[model samples]
Target: MLLIIVGTACGAPDTTAAEGTPETLETFTTTADALTVQNCSPLPTSSVLASGDDGAGSVANNTRDDRLDTRWSALGKGVWIDYDLGSVQSLSGAAIAWHQGNTRVNTFTLYVSTDGVNYTQVYTGKSSGTTTAAETYTFATRTARRLRITVYGNTLNDWASIAEARVCGAPATGSSVVWRGDFETGNISQWTSTQMVSADRLQVISSPVRSGKYALKATVRQGDDPINSSGNRNELVKMTREAVGSEYYYRWSTMFASDFPSVKTWQLFTQWHHEGSSGSPPLEFYVYGEEIRLNIGGDPGTLVWKAPLVRGQWQDFILHVKWSPEASVGFVELYHNGQLVLPKRNIATMFPGMLNYLKVGLYRSDTVTQVGVVYHDGWIMARTLADVL
Candidate 1:
C-alpha cells in the first residue's frame, strides 16, 4: 500500500500542468518571502514560512513542507521553507532563532538575489552546524534578500528547529542578484537530487554522498533494489534538474566497487523524459531497456561490453553532446579518464529532440545478490560543447 509517506506525497508528473511537479517553483505573494520560519514562530512579518507537521503531534496530518519536490529525509530532521523573491533585498547578514537546543552537526547555505527572479549564492557555512548557529559573512552587500536553506543533519532523528530567519544590510551598490541556492560554497551550486525508488519502498538516504573531490556516489546493500527498475538487485539514478539543448558538455570521474556478478546484466544509462509526455519509456544510450547498446558485438552505438566496467578503480568520463538541426542527428562522445574509451564522432541515438534533464549515475543488477557502490567526483559543468571539450 502507498503510505502517504509524509505530506502530500507528490504524485508522478502531471504533464497537463505547465511545469511538472518537480519544476513547479513557488512564487512569493508577500514581503515575508525574505524569511524562513520553522518549528518556532508567529510567522515573520514578511516571510514565506508556513507551519507543517514534522511527523509528530498529529496523525494523518503529519507532513514535511519542503520546496524541492522530494523530502530531505524520512528520518525527520528535514524541515525547510522556500520562496521566490519578488524583488531583491539589500541583504547583509542573518539572525536565526532556534527553538530546539542548539546543535553542532547540521549544515546550511545562504543564496542571494537581485531581480528576485534569479538567484546567486553569497555565503556558506564552514562551522556553525546548528539551527541556533548564527553566521555572518562578507558578501559585499548584495540586493538579494531571498534564500533557501537545505539543512543536512549529521544526527539521524535529531531535527533542527527554526523560530525565525532574518536578512540584514542594505542592497549592494550596483550588484544585481539573479539566481541562488542557499549557502552553497564551492561547486554545490551545480548539485541536484533525485529519488528513483517508488514511494512504497523504504529510501532513508534522502541525500547521496559526495565522493572524491566532487564525485556523486551511489551506495546500496545486498537487497537494495526494491522496485527493480533494472531487474536483479539494482539501484537507479535520475536527474533532479531538467536541461535541454544541443551544446552542453558534462564530465565527471567515477569508481565502482566490483560486486557485479559475471552472469548479471549490467549497463550505464541516461534516461530523459520530456515535461508533458506520458509513457514508461526512457531515453538511454548504453543500455536501452532490456538490451545492451554500446561498444561491443554490434555497431559501436548499439554494442554492449563483453567485459564489465573495471571495479575497485577510478574511471574518468568526458561526455560531449552536440545538437543538430535535424533533431535526431545529434552526436555523443565518451572519454574514459584521459583516454577515449567510447570514440568521438559516434552517432548514438535516443528519444524526442528536447530533454528535461540527464541522469548521470550507475544502473546495475548483478547475478549474485551482493552489495554495490559507485563513487564519482571532479568537475560537473554545463556549458557550450566548445567550453567543455
Candidate 2:
C-alpha cells in the first residue's frame, strides 16, 4: 500500500480555492523546439583524441570522421576519448554510435570542462546496447570547450569502441526567472512550512547552502508529530499556482545529511502532489539508500527512472514538465547534475480535474527510527529551459 504523509492539518479545508487558484491550461510544446536552436552535433573545428589507439585502423579520429566503416577502438577498461570544441560553447546533448552498437550494453560517464584541467561529471549511465544507430543523450545546457567520455566496461568485452561521437547545443541565452527561494532573506518567509508540533521540523540554517548565507533545513526525528493523517514530516509547499496543460521548468539543489537513514521504506524529499486529495502524489522524488527513484502515480503506478543518490555533496536538478492527465499531452524531462537522465517521456502527470503543487522536505515511514535531515537551496521556476539551465 502507498502510505503518504500529508503535511497540512487533518481535515484542513481545501485552502487552494480560498487562496490563489491554479493557472489556466496553456499550449503544449516539446523540448526539441528549444534545444534544436543550438545545434547539438560535433563541431567542424573540434579536435578528437584518445588514449590507447588500437593501431589497425581504429583511432580517435575515426569516431569524429562521420564514417560508419571507421571506428575508434581501445583495449581494456578505463579508456577515454577527449573532444576539444576549439572554443567554449553551450552544450545541450551528446550522441554516440557504438562500433558493435546493438551487441552489448556499455557503461560510461560524460564529463565537461572549460579549462581542460578541471572537469565536472554531467552524465553517467549505461547505454541501451543497440548497434549501428547513434544513441543520443541530453542534459541541461552548459558552457564548455572540452568533452570527455570515460568507458568503464561493457556487457560483452573489455574493448571500448565507438563509430562516432557528436555534441549538440547553442550559445546560452539566459532563461527568465519566475520565482526563487535562496533563503537570502535569513528566513523562510517566502515559503510555507507544514509543521504539526512545536518541535523544530523546519528551520533556516547558515551552512551547507549552494549559495547565499542561508538554506532551508528539514529535520524529521522519531516521535515527531504527524499531519493530515500522514506520517511525520517537515515539508514546505509552494502555494498552488499550476493548472492542467501548463508547462514549467524547475531547478533546485539538494543534499542528504551524512547520518541520513537507509531504510527500505519510502522517504520523500520532493514531490508534485495533486491539489484534489490526500493520496499518492502525481510525481514523487524519493530515496532508497543511494538510489533515487521517480514514481508516477496511476492505477498501477509507474517507476520512470532511478539514479545514484550521491550524499554529502549538493546535487543539482532541472525538471521540465507539462502537466496533464492524458498520456499524449503530459510529459517529463529530468536533468540530474546537468545530465539529461530522463528524456522527455509521455506520462499522466495529473488526475482528472486536479492541479498539482510543489512540496519539498523530508517525509518518511514510521518504520524509520533514526533522525533524518536534508538541506535545500537554489529553488527556481521558469517558463523555458534556458531559464532553469
TM-score per prediction, in order, is 0.39, 0.55
**Distance from true location, Cα of 347 in model 1, Å:** 4.1
What is the Cα-based TM-score of model 2? 0.55
Against the unseen true structure, what C-alpha lDDT does each candidate score?
0.37, 0.71
lDDT (C-alpha) at residue 117 in model 2: 92
Model 1: lDDT of residue 99: 34
Write model 2 residue lDDT over 1-389, tens digit each, in one string: 12244432211112222212322223323222111111333333347878777889788977754355678899878899998877897786677877777888989989999998998999888889865666777777789998888898789888888877777554336654557767788877776545435446778888978877998888888766655444567778775445444567898899998888886656788887765444467788888666778888531257888887777889888988877666776799999988999999998787654556678888766557999999999888876887765
> What's the lDDT for residue 135 in model 1?
36
Off by over 4 Å in 2: 1-175, 226-228, 298-300
Best by TM-score: 2
After superposing candidate 1 on the true structure, give the runs of residues whose Cα lies further than 4 Å from its correct spot: 1-190, 196-216, 225-245, 267-301, 304-308, 323-328, 346-350, 366-368, 384-389
